[model samples]
Target: MRSVRRTLRTLQGDLARDIALVLLADGIVGVSFGAITVSAGLPVWLPMLLSVLAFAGASQFLFVGIIAAGGNPVAAVLAGLLVNARHVPFGFAVGDVLGRGWRRWAGIHLMIDETVAFALAQREAERRRAAYWACGVGLFVCWNLGVVLGAVAGTVVSDTAALGLDAAFPAVLLALVLPSLRDKTTGAAALVGVAVALVATPVLPAGLPVLLALLALPIAFVLRGRLDEPAHVREEASCPSR
Candidate 1:
């Protein structure tokens, strides 16, 4: 009991900051999603469920777009899964901080990009937990609020096309992916995914290109090992001299 209280106390500030930031960021993005959802002719509740349950902005956007584009539900779900597969690695990276048992499960479920980034930024385990929960809950509330607001207002808003709501998803995705291009390998992988998607666009359905992008993962893994070997060898050689 004492330990729990201590942990909670340590988390207070980080929790406040993280929740605030996440709410702000997610609220903006949620507006985009809500706008698109309304324009796509989906039921208002659909966006609400998506925002509340899915809680993954990119995946929710992709799912709605795929469905609106006349794609199958299976295809839409698969595309969303492929797009979010990166979260699996992010979860692994933060596993240590997540602790074990129920807390671990909570941490994993809440391990979105913002939560992961904030938690990883913290040097202490306790701080990481606080940050994660703060962002996670903050994003959840703000995201759902935006979805509801957009859905309700969307019905009355005219000329969704004129508003260019359809472009929001791609623009947001590009923004999310662009910053992660830190190295040649990752850059090449992203380039290849885009190229593959473009080439497959005509041949495949709206959601299929996403799957093709996922297929590039194995190739990246192979390349990653080869890319790291030279650096590892150089470090080993230098260590012997010391």
Candidate 2:
């Protein structure tokens, strides 16, 4: 009881602003996703369900985009899985902080990009757990709420394209990717992903282009290793006698 109280207080004071910012952004994007999904001719309930279940923003957009374009469901699922492959490493990295048993299981469901990043940003174990739960639970609630509202709005409206909501999904996706471009490795990976997707789009099926984009992951890893060698050698040379 006391422990839970302390956690809440700490979250309120320290993480409130950060969580609020995420909620606001996520709410808007979630709304866009819902609106776009409905505009694509899917039932409102579909996006609402996806927001609760799949929860990852980029893959969700891809799934809807593919379906909207008359792509195969299998292809969309495969592409979505490919995009979410990063979560495997994310799980390994934060496995320790997730606690044991049921908590671990539940934590896996809550593990998204923002939650993982916020949790890992903390140095202390306690704070890391707190941040993870705070971001996860907060986002889950806000995102779902936004989805419901957007779906409702989408159902009521006609001609979402004229309203410019058609572009919202891609715009949000670009916003998500822009920050990562600050890192040379990520930027290179993104370029490779984009090139592969663009090239494949002309020849391959709709969702298959996204699958081809997965090639960027290994390319990024190899580039990172090669890029680090020079710095490693320089540091080795600069080291005092050891």
Q: Which candidate is the best by TM-score?
A: 2
Clashes of each: 0, 0
lDDT (C-alpha) at residue 81 in model 2: 85
lDDT of 1 by residue, 1-242 (tens): 66566656877764565457546656756766787788888787888888777778778988998999989999899988876877776777777777788877766667777777667666678887766676676677788887787787774443335556546435534544565655667777878887887899898755557557766677677788888999788999999789
Models 1 onward score TM values of: 0.62, 0.67
Candidate 2: tens digits of C-alpha lDDT, residues 1-242: 67557667767664667667777777777777788898788988889998899988778989888888999999889888877877887788888878888878878999888788777766678888888888888889988888788888874433446666557545634554476676788799989998999988887645567657778999889988988998788889889765
Q: Candidate 2, clashing residue pairs?
A: none
Which segments of model 2 are wrong by more than 4 Å? 1-3, 155-242
Mind sharing the TM-score for model 2? 0.67
How many backbone clashes can be found in candidate 1? 0
CA lDDT of 83 in candidate 2? 76
